[model samples]
Target: MGSLLLLTRIGGRPAAFRAEDIGSIVELTEIAPVPRAPDFVAGLTGLRSRALTVIDSRKALALPGTPDPPDVRAPVVEVGGHAYALLVDRVDDVVAAEGEPTPPPATLGPAWARVACGMIETAAGPAVLIDVAALVAGPHRAAA
Candidate 1:
């Protein structure tokens, strides 16, 4: 079944995902920093009775860094086995796409293709669809 993915910004680019992938959406909050982990590791937080690793999406995508928010990006995540938080610029509401799926750019636009399903036109311009599993553990996503 098709689902709605809450939209967010990665590297200032528009992005989305299926609702199933999301555990929960919390406003920018504090994180307990991780030691010796990747710079992108924004740290961890508890959600739905589990700890999810918050990460800097821009850093993970190798984009230029932005100022650290006193209240950081919403940590929309997937947990259980694969756990990682995407630090987006901000988040919008979940959009349900209608009609056929639009294809992403032929070339894997950013190095984030594994996660990107492609761009689809909504009432609001074109939204990039993302595969949560791919985003977290695709061949493209670098190792920790």
Candidate 2:
């Protein structure tokens, strides 16, 4: 059997995260902006009395920002002992992988290449398998 995946959309493109890497999915009602933080860092929000750093998946991929409604959907994850919420364009169903991940195409581009693990087939079709840790790290830190 292939890995289970949580499908999502980022920058208007299909993407997935290994299900084992995610803690939960949430709808953020409020985010307090973080000054002096990296551009990809959306800000901070609360979840279960715990603070979560919101990472804008678009900015993390070096894409331009879109006007977001007050509420945002995100997948929750923990990396290096810190919790983070990855803001995505949309959240889709959780599906089992149809096959193992294969190398991403050359045209995947630098921003994607930096965080993409590979491409995987799912019932929903093909999606770029994203590295949760890499996404939370942001483009600058992941590149370094």
Candidate 3:
């Protein structure tokens, strides 16, 4: 398949998610914190009358420092029937995949490698294709 990638910045590093995996991009104005939820969960926000569990991608990747504040843009996605808005540092352009995603390089760090489906080429450069399911699952998922 000729995949389309939505390039984004997570933890200040270039990343991509398959375009098909996103439901919509949304600008979150409010988020109510969920008690006892994992640290990666940024809380919940309503989207078109539906509630979305916002995930801080940086935290989900086990990156350092505090996550980007709410009122940030996110990509909405449904994983296992649950809706989620993944918080990203920046939402960049969509680009055509030059080829199928390939194995990420050895130099890839544990945090990114944990959720990386593969690396794909784009006009801008090679970006690790993020596995949305694994990302929403949290940073503890076993690396593939």
Whole-model Cα lDDT of every candidate shown, in order: 0.66, 0.88, 0.88
Candidate 3 regions exceeding 4 Å error are 66-71, 141-144
Residue 52 miss distance in model 2 (angstroms): 0.2
Cand. 1 Cα-lDDT: 0.66
Alpha carbon lDDT of residue 20, candidate 2?
93
**Model 1: residues >4 Å from true position, as ranges?**
67-75, 79-83, 107-110, 138-144
Model 3, 17-46: lDDT tens per residue?
999999999998898999999899999999
Across 77-136, the per-residue lDDT of candidate 2 in tens digits comes to: 999999999888888889999988999999999889988999999988999999888888
* TM-score of each prediction: 0.76, 0.92, 0.91
The top-ranked prediction according to TM-score is 2
Candidate 3 lDDT (Cα, 0 to 1): 0.88
Clashing pairs in 3: none
